[model samples]
Target: MNGSHETEIRELMKSYFDGLYHSSSDILRTVFHPDLAYVNGTTGNYEHLDFEEYMARIDARTPPASRGDVREEIIERIAFKGDRIGIVEARMTMMGRNYQDLLTIINTDDGWRVLTKVFSFVERKA
Candidate 1:
């Protein structure tokens, strides 16, 4: 992808995460594709969740937690396989620990949508 495409998608992704923490569900809808799926491993356990299911969980449990600014270090762009799809890997810091997120994105007629996001959690060592 070109710099403009990358920048736009990255910004939207950041906005997506921030919107979630800030309780702006409307903005959340902008980035997260309805079919998105996720999986994560932390402290030796792996877990998986699908999009609508995950959102239901978030809506039920998250009482609008505090959020810091979104800062991501893009490790690399895996490739844009076609006009419709792309992959990116980045490291994001939350609460002082770095979490790695991999995004599978699609370019719909409206713009880019995050089809899926897989993340690994990093615990802060004492």
Candidate 2:
């Protein structure tokens, strides 16, 4: 991947984490594709949500920052399959819980956008 292209992807990933930390749907809207489908399973059941559903959830919640949740993030890797495809692995703390996310990103005519997110809630040990 071109260095500039990689940089833009990194920036988009940063925005994603920041959006979760800040609970800013506007920021997330820019980073995720309109057709995004986010999947997660940790409560003994799987939950699937489209972009609008997830955004509405964000809109209803209190921002993690507002609740004094310290933001923590680790971007594990960003790998490219070609000019148009990239995969990102990352973890972040939000609302006092940890989440690991694998993002499928694609470069569209408009820009880089996250197409899908496969994630799980990480449980903290006592």
Candidate 3:
């Protein structure tokens, strides 16, 4: 990928991490597309949530940052199939748990938008 594309994707992922850290709906909405489909099956059941549901969950939760939860995020990789489609893998720390998320991103007329997320989380034992 070109440097500019990489930079743009980095910023978008940064927004995603910041949104999760702060529980900010606006920031989350900016990076994620409205028709986003998020799936997680780590809890033994296949679960899916749309963008609105996800944002609502974020709104309901107390931000990890506010609780003094130490947070770290790393963008593991970004791969592109063409000019429009990209995939990102990242690991993050929040709410005393660790999460790894695979995000599918697309470059639209508006800009780069996260199309979907498939994630897994592990709760840390005290």
Candidate 4:
């Protein structure tokens, strides 16, 4: 399981974006934990909400149909002492925006589940 944690997290991330592309929140259910956190520039304000809060936002809002690449990255990877906890640094290109997201997840009894996902925009220098 130790060797596969990173791969598992990568798959979780892939599913996450794919979920958004299809607006199928069910796919999200497979990736996030009940108490996950999400942050992005779109909020205009920051929110530190749990899973329900996150899901409600997703449920309430509608994303353009596959407007951009999941453009998400696997920049850096680290496995914790328990090997069950992993932190990943990645970037995503969504709707023409470039994002750097920090994903924290745990390999739980069920499988790899994201505990938190925080993202901020990265401006490219001309």
TM-score against truth, every candidate: 0.74, 0.94, 0.95, 0.76
Query: Would you give me the overall lDDT of model 1?
Result: 0.71
- In terms of TM-score, the best-performing candidate is 3
Give me the runs in candidate 4 sitting further than 4 Å from their true place: 41-44, 66-78, 122-126
Best by lDDT: 3
Alpha carbon deviation, residue 100, candidate 1 (Å): 0.5
Q: Specify the poorest-scoring 10-residue window by lDDT in model 4.
A: 66-75
What digit string (tens of lDDT, one per residue) describes model 4 on residues 1-126?
A: 465766667677788777765666788889888778776644565657778877777776566464544444445555555776877776665555667778788878989888888877755433
Q: Which has the higher TM-score value, candidate number 3 or candidate number 4? A: 3
lDDT, candidate 2, 1-126, per-residue tens: 689888999899889988888889999999999999999966785899999999999999899889887788988999999889989999887765788889999999889999999998866543
lDDT (0 to 1) per candidate: 0.71, 0.89, 0.91, 0.70
Please state every model's RMSD to the true fold in angstroms. 3.2, 1.3, 1.1, 3.2
Model 2 whole-model lDDT (C-alpha atoms): 0.89
Model 3 lDDT on a 0 to 1 scale: 0.91
Question: Which window of ten consecutive residues has the lowest lDDT sum in model 3?
Answer: 38-47
lDDT of 1 at 96: 52
Off by over 4 Å in 3: none
- For residues 22-101, what per-residue lDDT tens digits would candidate 1 score against the true structure? 66556767887888887776657688888777776666644344544444454545567767788877675555567888
